[model samples]
Target: MASTMSRLMLGRTLERICKAVLLLCLVHFLIMMILYFDVYSQRFDIFSRFNNGRGANASRGPHHYYYNYSRPNTTFPSYLPGADQLLPTAKPEANRTRPTPKPIPPCPEVPPGLVGRLLIEFSSQMTMERVQRENPNVTEGGKYTPTDCRPKQKVAIIIPFRHRDHHLKYWLHYLHPILRRQKIDYGIYIINQLGEDTFNRAKLLNVGYTEALKDAEYDCFIFSDVDLIPMDDRNLYHCYDQPRHFAIAMDKFGFRLPYAGYFGGVSGLSKKQFLKINGFPNEYWGWGGEDDDIYNRITLNGMKVSRPDVRIGRYRMIKHERDKHNEPNPQRFNKIQNTKNTMRKDGISSLTYRLASVKKYPLYTNISVEIGKPPPRPIKG
Candidate 1:
């Protein structure tokens, strides 16, 4: 009977030990899950060595990460793309040279006109000179850094322009105030195609990007059409995990998305993201297929497009007739259908353009370039 009692006590202790182990495992799994979610949501990209506008983490000290353990090695940044150079960086330890981050500007209370719609009466009263007079905050070379403080991202606004000064006047009037209210450091570059060659929207965009970089390092580029303007300030202009389509709703499409993959009108792309796909194709001359080509490039590179909710992205396109010598490219259809074949060879890497002139106005910078001509149309294999 004593032997039987000993067996019973030993079994009970073993069972108790097993229960404790299971409980500890459950607690550990729950903790791991919480950490995974925080990192996934990008609440903080702590390991992000430089300022990719991932926001600040005050608790991070100089020795947060170490290569040699004896001393902090701050020489090499993470293996981020080339575009990462556009963002700011923290001061490295021991006077190491690194890009310093710009300060955060104060967010002021800015009101919009009636649900963010521009009344004809209000907009008609706005003039180009009036807009210029209102913006006294611009720095040298038509750059606007937020007056109250530093800004989150340094943005370069690239407008593809050949003509349409009247449309541009309206755009400057509406967009400048909206961008200022958003409190971002930005500059405007109006890329104009020189001479009477067929309008190559994509090549000009490539030119705009290269030229803008020559002037200042831009974290992101907003390729905006001079004729289209956003109605709501809520549709913020910034980069994300993927490219973003700001014109979610346009009057041209009856105030809704025209199709599933339409990434036209005003759009945003970080430099790294743009470079990953070699930028837009320089072969998409004229107006028809460049935007679609851009969409395909993004998708092919394992990135998806993101946009604000439809209600937030409402925009109005200023109506106009097609400009003289700007006929539709007959080859757009064939090129778009055969994107998978030509994309690798015909993008920014192969882009060619001659700088004709660069002019800085009170509102923005204007860069005129000779994009030359598109190669003879190719036959499908």
Candidate 2:
């Protein structure tokens, strides 16, 4: 009875051992299958090892890739047997359509006899002493002829600037052509500070608005930066009925806005509209806060800001060295919080700046204004 019991125990132990061994083998097989053919295993790009053996060279046949790059055959494929042969043959010479050049419009045709006399008369009438005199077409008191001198719409290209010469050059080169084509009779006024204190970007902008209107009646003002260049000719600097954000999708932010309420780089506002909002806050000295403060001013005064489409509002930035005293102002946030109260007191009406010089060339004019100094530190209580 003892021997029989031992035999039964031994048999049961062997059966359990065999089952455990089989399960181990099955688990190993499943792991191998997962590493080889699982859906996610194929997509695993991390830590993948490439075969460095000589046999792997056989798979990359030289002729297989070389033949793919050869020039394509001119003849049609074998499936379309007669397609090439059925095509019409070219003639040696053919009649081509040559476009006719547009005829230049002739100069206003006056009678030949009066041309010389009219020139002498015009010259005599345009003397400095008789500048206030009027011809038949001119209004009795007006010196300028109604038709001869088209009334120049006063436009001020107000640039908020610091030390950015290279970027400024690119802006000037590109924008001069654009403004001239617009034919609004504009002036480019870069309100540069005399010395390097904390860079007051918004104050310079307000200075531009206040000073630009002092010399002439500037109906429209463009608040632009030196770095941003308009990608399309359609970006008119002139404002519409509402405030216009010119630089909408810049390459700096991957041709898309980082977030909503982004008002940076180029923007435009009419004189009346700008004054109504008391102009931009002077406290945002460094890089940030000015844009957001302006946006707040627009919304609080019951004005909506409009922007150009992403495609049309594209701009290119000129990469260059950073400016002195124009480092990112760390206290921009504190000042931005108090913008509403401060802007009313320190803005356009209370603003003060001096004219450095004014020069009028044949094509356009240049007006330099000494904004004098930046405001006290925004951090100080």
Which candidate tops TM-score? 1
Give candidate 1 misplaced runs (Cα > 4 Å). Answer: 1-127, 376-381
Model 1 C-alpha lDDT per residue in residues 25-128, reported as the tens digit of each score: 99999999999997675634534544533446532553233333345663444554442333235443676766887865454434232245554223465666
For candidate 2, the TM-score is 0.56
**lDDT of candidate 1 at residue 272, scale 0 to 100:** 96
TM-scores for candidates 1 onward, in order: 0.68, 0.56
| Top-lDDT structure, candidate number | 1
- Model 1 TM-score, 2 decimals: 0.68
What is the C-alpha lDDT profile of model 2 across 1-381, one tens digit per residue?
999999999999999999999999999999988877765654342112122112344224221111232366645345433333222342224554568967544322221222110000111212322321212222221111112223334567777765655455455545655544443446667676666666777878887777667656778888888778777765656667898898898878998987788888888888778988888876566678889888888887899988977887888777666677678878778777776777678577776667676554322234455665555654656
Give the number of colliding residue pairs in candidate 2.
Answer: 0
Per-residue lDDT value at 244 in model 2: 88
